[model samples]
Each structure stands twice: as structure tokens, then as C-alpha cells.
Target: MKKVVFKVGGSILQELPESFYKLLIELKEKKVCDPVIVHGGGPEINQALEQMQIESTFIDGLRVTTEEVLEVAQMVMCGAINKRIVSLFQNQNGKAIGLSGVDGKLLQAKPIKDGKLGFVGEVTKVETAWIDMILQAGGIPVISPIAAGEGETHLNINGDTAAGAVAEALGCRLVLISNIPGVMETIDQKEIIHHHLTKEEVEALIDSGVIYGGMIPKVRSALASLQGGVEESVILNGLEPGDILKYLDGEKVGTILSEKEVVEHV
Candidate 1:
């Protein structure tokens, strides 16, 4: 059976509607493919941290997860967001299981070297066995991006990185659903980049400052997945109902990335 990894960001998770759930049900009913969802809950985590009066910081788009912020991250990512997504699938007549990096030693990581950013992690290992078991049982596994490292160290990993690692490990296609349609050539909202991009092209866009800030990490993660041997990686607007199916059907639904492709002009 084919497998696909869907990386749902905190923004989309918070805004997901009934239509999205219906679409998931459709996918399951059709047996389109086995899906593993890796999720992040940054907004919710930030809210919880604010409530607890813990100041959060970021360095190079990665959250500087201090001890206090890490507590809130664990609570929001594992306790709330993970379970909520699982319940959504269950409500839609689909079997869903919630998991974390700590579960079954699924994800292990090492500390990232941003000295100012406290406990951020870069994924070192991803075990696909548990995820496969859940898929074999006809259930979706919802993963939270908190990894346990050597010793008593638990690190907060970037959601995109975690998702990419999981996809690479499973050799599955990676689909990242974000609020935007896809990458764009211009800052103009209408100029959506709908074609596949090569690594060189991606680098040029970044160097030209067309891609900046938050998009950098996301695009990099997608590239990493492709380089790691995933067949394809796509970035699409999650708000659009049935967009996932559209993309899977070979329709031009988003920005696709892969190695250089030979194009023939007739």
C-alpha cells in the first residue's frame, strides 16, 4: 500500500472545519493511501505559555523552547492538539491514534546548535514501525513534534523537520498543508508558483530574497524530504476542501518539488 505523510501546522489545525474532516473520511473510504499526520500546535502553545507568564523567544524561525515553554509545548502539542486531531478522525468514522515522539521511541533527536535557542532539537532518528502498525490496524497516527534525546533530555523539534524525518523514514510522499496556496514568485497574493522547482531554483529564490523568514524553514524541510528519497513533496493550502485529492490526482493544486526534471517542448 502507498503511504503519504501529511504535516498539519498549528494554524490549520486550529482552523480546520467539518469539511476537512469529511474529506479525510472520503480518503479513508476510498482507501486512497495510508496517511500519517505529523502536527504542531505553536499558537496554542504560545497561548498557554502566555497564560502561565512564560516569555517565549525564537532564533532563526525555530522556537527557543526554554524549560517553562517546553512544559507548555508538551501540554499543548501532546495533550491537546494530538488528541483533538485523533478525535476528529474518529468522529468522521475513521480510526485514529494519537502519538508523540516519546511514544515507543518513535523519534530521537540531538540539540540544535543555536546557542541562544535553549532546547530545540534536530531529528536524529525516526522509527516507522509503530506508525506502520497503526496503519495496518486501519488507523491514522497523529504525531506531536516532541522528541526525547539521550539521557534526561527532551527537545522541542520543529514540526516541519519532524514530519520530513518521518516521511523520509517511511519513504512516503510528504504533503505539507499550510494556510497559503503555495510558494510565489512575487509578493503579490495572486502570483502563485504552481510548477515544480529544482534545488538550484529554490536557492536562487532564497538568495534573491523572494523566500524569506518562516517560509525558509518550510521550504528547506520539503527539500530535505525530497533529497532523503521521498518520491515527491508538495505544499498546498489546507483550507481548500478536497485539495489533497486534487493534488494526488495529478492536478496542479500546489507547488511541487523534486530533483531536476527534463522538460520537452513541442
Candidate 2:
């Protein structure tokens, strides 16, 4: 069976409908594919930091983790957000195990940029055996992106990056669940979603200014994961009901980013 790693951000966690959880349960019950979720807790962490009077900062979509920030991040991602997701799945009658990269050494890492980001590290390794165990046990693994670094240090990881690593390690597809439908371009006065895009095509679109602003980072991140051995990175709207299922069912519901060339949607 195939496995699909989902990267869900905290910004959309509350907005995800019950139908989404139900769909996940349905997929598991039907043995469609093993669905693994790697989640972020950015907004929640920010809120907690504010309550504790700590400044929140980021560099290129990655949080700058000070010692205090890491503490709060751990509490939020591993404690609150993690359990909440597990509870949601359990509420839907789906068995789920919430975990952090620190749990079972699922993800091992080291400091990046000479610790310029301060406890923010990139995943150097992903232990896929634990994830396989959970999948074999008929349970979904909801992972928080807190990685175990050298010594006793715990590091904060990017949700997308973590999910990409997991997908690459498992040789599975990476589905990035976000608010937007996909990469859109106005053609003939109508907004159209590009169903598929290659790395070069994405760059051309960015140069043409069709892809700009917030989407730039998202698409670039997806493309970067392609270079990291991920077969495809899918960007779709989690807010839209059935978009994920539609894509899974072979309907054109999102933008698929791959290194290879493909027919572009016109």
C-alpha cells in the first residue's frame, strides 16, 4: 500500500472540518493508503509566546527559536496541539498516535547555519520504522516537528520540511494541505489552477510574476523537496471539501510539482 504524508499548518487546524477527519477515517478503514500527518503549531506557539511576553520572529518561514521560544514551542506542539489532533481523530473513531520527532527518535538532526537560527534545525534523518509500526497497527501517526538534535538538545523543525523528509524516506507522495486551492494564473480573464508543474515551469511562472508573494515560498519549498527525492509535492486547498479525495481519485484538484516535465493545464 502507498503512504501519503500530509503537512498541515496550525493556521488551518481549527478550520479543518469534521468531514476531513471522517475522510481520513474512511481512507484508513478502506485500506486505500496509510495516511501520516506532520503538523505545525506556529500560530499556537506565537499565541503562547505572547502570553508569556516573549518575542516571536522568523527567518524565511522558519521560526527563530530562542531557548524560551523552544520551551514554549515544545509545550505547544508536543503537548497541546499534538494531543488535540489525536483527540480529533479518536473522536472520529480513527485510531491515532500523536508524537514528536523527539519521540522514538523519529527524526534526528543537527544545527543549521552554525546555529544562526538558534535551536531550529533541519532534519538530517527520519526513522521510518516507528512510522511503519504505527501504520501496521492500523493507526495514523500525527507528528509534531520537534526534532532531537545532538546531545540533549531538542530542535524546532519546519512542518513542510519534516513532512517532505518523511515522504522521501517512505518513498511516498507529499500532500501540503493549505488554504489556497493551488497555483493560479489569470488566463483569458479567468483564474485557472495549474494542475501540474515542473521545476523549470515554476521558475518561469515566478519570473513572469504569475507566482508571487506568499505562494513563492510554498512552491519553492515543494520544488526543493522534489530535489530531496520526493516523487511529487501536491498543493491543495484543505478548506475545500473533497479536494484531497478528488485528487486521490484521479481528478485534477491541485497543483502537482515534480522535477519531470508534464502537460500544463491551460
Candidate 3:
């Protein structure tokens, strides 16, 4: 079966309708694509931290994970949010198994920036067989981004990077689901979707400040997924779940990234 990895950000996870979950169930049952989901819990984590009287911050889409914050992140990402998604699937009669990177040693990691970002980690390696097992059993694997660290430690990883690493390891397709349409360009004061982008063009836009905020790591992750052996990487709006069908059906749906220039479609 062909594999497809999805990175669903926390911002949209809560707002997603039942229709989205149904589509996923339909796709999996039909064997359209073996879907592996890597999800983020930024907003949820922040809410939890604030309620617990802990401060949380982010740098370039990656949460600056302090030991205290890491505790909350794990709690929210692995405990609450993960189970919630699983329950949602069960509610819809869909099959899903929620697991953390620490589970089955799925994601191995090392500290990013010499531990300057505290417990923030960069994915050093991804173990795909664990995920493959779940998929082969006909269950979607809902993964949390917290990774296994050296000797009884755990690290918080960027969601997009985690998804990219998984895609690379599995050598599959990756679709980063977000709230927006895709990478946007402000041409003549109008936000225009790039429709398609190359790494060079994405970098140029980033350097020119067209791509900033959370989008920086998102595009970079898409690029990484492409370089990491993914057959295709795209940024798609989860609001329109039907677009996923369009994309899987080989129709243009979102911003498809490329390493080399490709002719743009109207």
C-alpha cells in the first residue's frame, strides 16, 4: 500500500469537523493511502501551561521546551490530545492507534542548538518499521512529536520536522495540513497562493520576508520531506477535506513543492 504522512497542527485539530475524520476513515478503508498522522499541540499545550502557571514560548515554529514545559507538552501531546484524536476516530468507527515517539523507539533525537533551546530536539533518526506495523494492521498511527532522548530523557520536537523525518524514513508522500490554503504570496497587496514552489523559490521568498512566522518551518519541512525521499510533499488546507481526495486522485489541490522548476497551472 502507498503511504501518506500528514502533519496536522493544533490550531486546526480542534476545529476540524466530523466530516474530516470520516474522510480519513473512508480513505484508509478503501486503501487509497496508508495514512500516518503526526500532530502538534502548540495552542493546547500553551493553554495547559498557562492553566498550570508555566510560561511557554516558541522560536520559529518550534516550541522552546524547558524541562517544566516539556512535562506539560508531553502531558498534552501524548496524554490528552493523542487520546482525544483516537477517541474521535473510535467515535466515527475508524481505527487508530495513538503512540508517542518514545513508544517502540519510533523517533530518536538529539538536542538542537547545543541544548540552547532547552529540551527542544531535532529528529536524528526515524524508525519506520514500528509505524509500518500499525499501518499493515490497517490502523492509522497518530503520533506525538515528543521524542526519545539519551538514557531516560525525552525531547520535544517540532511537529513539521517530525512528520518530515517520518516521511523520509518511510519514503512516502507527505501532506502538511494547515488552516490556510497554502504558502501565500502578497502580490499587489493580495495574498496569492504559490500553487507550486521549488526550494529555491521558497528560500527566496523567506529571505524576502514573504514567508515568515510558523510558515518558515512548514515550508522547510516540506522541502526536507522532498529531499528525504518523499515522492511528494504538499501544504494543504484541512478546512477543505475534499481537497485531500482531489490530491490523492492526482488533481491539483494545494501548493505542491518541487526541487526543480515545473510549469505552473492556471
Candidate 4:
């Protein structure tokens, strides 16, 4: 059976609806493909931190996770968000299991720059065996981004990068579900970039500042996933019903990223 990794960001988690869950159920019922879900809860974590009167900071688009903020991030991402998604999948008649980077050492990491970002980690390894066990048990594994560190430490990993590592480790295709439809040619709200781009093209866009701010990290993550041996990677709007399945079915639902065009160039 083919496997695909779907990484849903906090933005989509906040807006996910029953219809979306139903679509996932339909995919399972049809045996379209085996899917493993990895997710983030940025906004929720930030809200919790704010309530605690803790200030948050970011460097290079990655959260500068101080210990206090790291606690909030763990509670929100693993405790709240992970369970909610698992429940939704189960409600849709899909067997789903929630996991964290800490589960069975599923994801191992080291601090990105030690004291620079406090608890922020760069994923060093992923144990795909545990994920395969969950899949074999007919469960969709839902992973949260908090990872336990080596000896008396805890690390906060970027959800997108974590998902990419998981996909690469499993040798599976990756679908990065986000708020936007896909990469845009212009920054205009309606300008959907419908064509596939080479690495050079993506670099040109980055150099031109057409892709800046939050988009820079996301695009870079997608590129990294492609280079890491995943067959393909796509960035699509998850709020739309059936968007992910549509993309998987060879429909032009989002911006697709790959090393080279497998299908007729479109």
C-alpha cells in the first residue's frame, strides 16, 4: 500500500470542519492510500502563553522557545491539538492514534543553536518503525511536534521540518496543508501559481522577494522534502473540502513541488 504524510498546520486545525473529517473518512473507506498526519498548534500555543503573561519570540521564522513558552507549546500542541484531531478522525470512523515526538523516541533531536532559541531543536533522527506499527494496526498516526531531548532536556521542533523528516524517513510522498491555495506568482490574493517550478525557479522567486516572511520557511521546507527522496510534495489550502484527496487524485488543486515533472508538464 502506498503511504503519504499529511502535515496540517495550526491555521487549518483552527478552521477544520466536519466535512473535512468526512472526506478523510471517505479516503480511508476507499482505501485510497495510507496516511500519517503530523500537525502544529502555533496559534493555540501562543494564545496559551499570552494568557500566562509570557512573551514569545521568533528567530528565522522558528519560535524562540523559552522554557515557559516551551511548556505552553507542549501542552497546546501535544495535549490539546493532537487529541482533538485523533477524536475527529475516530468520529469519522477512521482508526487514529495520537503520538508525540517523544513516543517511543519517534523523533530525536538536538538544540538548533543551544542557548539561541532555548528549547528549539533540529530533528536529528526519526524512528519510522513505531509509525509503521501504528499503520499496520490500521490506525492513522497523528503526531505533534514536541520532542524529548537527550538526557534531561526537551526540544521544540518546527512542525513542517519534522513532517519532512518523517516523510523522508518513511520514503513517502508529503502533502503540506496550509492556509494558502499554493505558492503565488504575485502576492495578489487570487493569483494562484498553477505551474510546477524547478529549484532554480524557486530560488529566483526567493531572491526577488516574491516569497518572503512566513512563506520563505514553508517553501524551503517543501524543497527540502523533495530533495530528501520523497516522491513529491505539495502545498495546498486545507480549509477547502477534499482538497488533499483532490491533489492526490491527480487534480490540479494546489502548487506541486518535485525534483522534476513526472507527469506531462502542466
Rank candidates, lDDT, best first.
Answer: 2, 3, 1, 4
List ranges where model 4 is wrong by over 4 Å: 57-62, 186-192, 262-266
lDDT of 2 by residue, 152-214 (tens): 999999888888889999988899888889999999999999989988999999999999987
- Find the candidate with the highest TM-score and give its number: 2
- Whole-model alpha-carbon lDDT for candidate 3: 0.87
lDDT of 2: 0.89
Candidate 3's residue-wise lDDT over 1-266, tens digit each? 78889899888898888878889889999888888999999888889888999866767655678889999999999999999999988899988999999997899999998887889898888888899889888799999999999999999998888998898888777899978888887878887888789999999999999899989878888888777777778988888899889888877668899787653422
lDDT leader: 2
lDDT score, candidate 4, position 151: 85
RMSD of each: 3.2, 2.6, 2.9, 2.7
TM-score for each of the candidates: 0.89, 0.94, 0.90, 0.89
TM-score of 1: 0.89
On a 0 to 100 scale, what is the lDDT of residue 90 in model 4?
84
Candidates by TM-score, descending order: 2, 3, 4, 1
